[model samples]
Target: MLKGKLKLPDRLGNLVVDFEDRDDKIGGSSSVLASSEELEIILPNGLGFSRHKDDGDGLCCTEEKKTNEAAIFRASARPYKDRAGSVSAMAFIAADEKRSDFEYQSELKKNTEEELSSSKQNVDGDSDGLLRRHEISSEDHPLSLGKASVWNQYFQHMDIIEQIDRDLKRTHPEMEFFSGDTSFSRKNREAMKNILLLFAKLNPAIRYVQGMHEVLAPIYYVFCTDIDEKNVANAEADSFSCFVKLLSDSVDHFCQQLDNSSGGILSTLSRMSELLKANDEELWRHLELTSRVKAQYYAFRWITLFLTQEFNLQSVLRIWDSLLSNPFGIQEMLLRVCCAMLLCMRSKLLSGDFAANLKLLQNYPDVNIEQLLHVANDLSPDVSSYCPPL
Candidate 1:
């Protein structure tokens, strides 16, 4: 057993790890070298694939006729790489950190104390290596169901995620951009499916998670909606390139090991609560301190899925405009947007009890998308001087 602390690198998060399993040089066998792709991802997710089916990547882009306009449009639009630092600042702060605006410091301190009392490990221990033996094959050892399930889930994660992506890609069928009972719509879905699959294949660390297609939808839509026909035809290639750039910073959210770290979704939720307290102290106290509502109860999906599930497609598209354009970074801007969401419902959240407030946030009421963006932009007025019109 390898006992020392082994620090693994993260490519796409350092997904692929090459390990020397053994030093035996029998017949110069290169097969002894184990890599991230030790096992093939073969779980069927409604989308059929024969054992011999080609990866479908080459056919996706080559089938379209190459055009000079396509190349030009690709260069002009989707400035994600150039505008890399797009989010607003102050993203993931620990519960007790100092803030600019007036906040409920005492109550926040109490909450942090309560969290530690639960024996929850903080950022330092978030990515602890697996300690327990994965397999116990002895005839005398009865199988532990818990360990078995964990083993299976860890190994089969890619397949399960592929199945999930298959289902989520069918979202909003009524929309003209991605669905319909026509050749055009089918072609669009195919292109999107290809992009999603390509992304998964490229980033083995985070193959595909549910609601990711939602992240891709607006990007694909914007590309398809391009006026030039060649650019429209070349949407898949352009979207694929831009999508990779778009998710580069936010990929940590997809890594389960980092879930509790400063980069994970929980840390983000903490930052969201902190942002709320900094802006609207009473409302923040009412929900977290008085009502004892955890940010994860409602904000989990919002923060993790980029608010795609909480709002409709059009509203989501509008929200992404602000998120992608912010100068801070997606994570920081996301916390601000989440805080703004709570602020928008200030009157309701304040008067309501735990049950009432929980219901309201879980089943979030219809919101003014433009106004929500406005509130997010208004947060931390001291740091940012220019709030772009949404």
Candidate 2:
């Protein structure tokens, strides 16, 4: 017989108890544990119980069995301390007549609690006393609780959350809204974090990435810096909606699964290369042959991050205006813009070798925005031309 005082911890409100029998050896003789005997527990009135089957390994309590032969009974208890610092016991007991195991186990838990209470009372009657009984239903249990805040659903993605926080802190360090320890900066960082979190939560596949904070910074900043002071306070909410809208069109590029589809990043790169070949065949061939610079090598970051990584804050914002305004969609216009960026540097790229050209494309030089957009608008893909692989 195992006998010892078991004090339940405060945090064990969702505790699950498992009962199993093992062979016992007395005086070098083995004896099998009998299933005929029933264990009894005397618990307080408020406690509740339910019968469930052991799913596997007899360790975890699974869903309640339908046949009513209770293979296992589990009791959940919530312990609370009163004003006088006296701890009260509340437990749940599972009862079913169809199964001897369930009936015996239910009785066992009830009797055990009652015996423990009696023993405690004998030791110190007035010191620690049981409080008024409040019934514990299945619905009241924490495990059976309803859905919490929508944000709570993403608790498993805490790593994503940490990454977002780190990225938010590092993004646009020069800007006061995202940089320092001021309340405004903290608010902006939080706004950015919330938007990214919601985006990941909604789209489980593409979820959050490192560079996304950069993409969202401008949107949130613009909303916060609105002319109307009232709009400033609601910047985060407005930014979230706008960011979702913006991401809807461009999210495909970020999805790795879609990278090789007809409309994936490869397709976009092909389109850009085709546009380049049509507009400036000499420049395209020179980069592809002599310079050995492929579109994916340089254009992957440019296209996926919405060119946010290639340019300064002011220039990116200007480019985004055109991107967001284009009814034909940003993908086509982005290809044109990328081509224009290359063409704008045609003079330098023509003279440079593979290394120099690759560096130039990776770290793009400044150009006249008005002229670049004009050149981009003028250029269009020759659909008839076969776009050979780079």
Candidate 3:
């Protein structure tokens, strides 16, 4: 059900299973193929049987279904759950953020012992073993690989954005429309342009710029993949155009001319600092004198785009998975991530005076990507609290 001018990886053209080296077998030898709603994974001889059940660990391939000549692998639930088979599918993309596919695939596969003993549970540990899993988990999300799946999710997000816009428009018809039909290419473009124009119109405080691409990339990918999956006939170009509109809308925030003071994330940080100062005075003073200024250099992108640039694509997708599902009131998961990062750097900050702390945090890449992700996951008191309402 993919649309126009689609390109899959060359190796993915025809799936091949390499079992020549191993003696294990799946479905009593012969040839076994597994089909999910999304893809078909073929198994050659020698790959052992994998169950399609959630045995506390993760989704597994369960049983092989038969039809006269050949057998197809289908997911199965073990003892308790009704749609046990569905758990396999659910592992890939669960509406429940805490138990979703992204959360299951951790990064520290081989180096489990090396992983920080922090309370945070990272989806992907920094192991070579989990890298592929991390990639697989977020392959469906836009932020991971920036494929069509991202476009699909974007459509859902846009639906909400438009829903909000329409509600606002009824009260004020002069308000610009933010939604567009996935099928109408030209209209989608026009609609998006109007939307961007409206964003500029609405937030005269920010002007259009090129760097907004980073934010729009994830949105567009989410929209495209979501649309393709839902409506099968939606044009890829149309989804892309809509994404462009989104970028156009946020252009003002990234304009180099805009300083930290006006409407951008710097403003958000200022507000956050004020909130912290009032709420956690000691932490605020420590951060201001030490990590805060350096945080400005490193934390700007994190705050502005929600760590989209800081971590790799897979990590970003999973992070957003938690972020989009957050129910907490702060409304910004990125802020929490910033808080987590500062916490991770606490030892360095505590060791030095304000200047040393600034020097250390700014120059040192002490917090690896995997550690940061773990901290991000753990920092949120409630994992469910990090995800914004869908």
lDDT of each: 0.67, 0.71, 0.46
Candidate 3 or 1, higher TM-score: 1
lDDT of 1 by residue, 1-390 (tens): 111122222311111111222224244465443432222222233232222223863222232222322332223222222233432112312222455322777678888999775444543355463343456554324343354454544545557556754664477766765667678777777788888877886776788887788778878888898999999989899999988887776687788888898678777677777777778888877888899999989888887778877887878888887887888666678778888888888898889999999999998889888888888888883233223432
The candidate scoring highest on TM-score is 2
Off by over 4 Å in 1: 1-165, 381-390
The better candidate by lDDT, 1 or 3, is: 1
Q: Which window of 10 residues has the lowest lDDT sum in candidate 2?
A: 13-22
lDDT per residue for candidate 2 within 56-126, as digits (tens), equals: 64422333332221222223234433223423233222223346687788999999999998977865666
Distance (Å) between predicted and true CA of 241, model 2? 1.4
Which candidate leads the pack in lDDT? 2
Report the Cα lDDT for residue 361, model 1: 91
lDDT of 1 at 357: 94
| lDDT (tens digit, per residue) of candidate 3 on 251-332 | 4346546556455555656655554454446766776764445446656665655565555445666666666565543235
Which rank order by TM-score, best down to worst?
2, 1, 3
Query: What TM-scores do the predictions have?
Result: 0.55, 0.59, 0.36
Residue 17 CA error for candidate 3 (Å)? 99
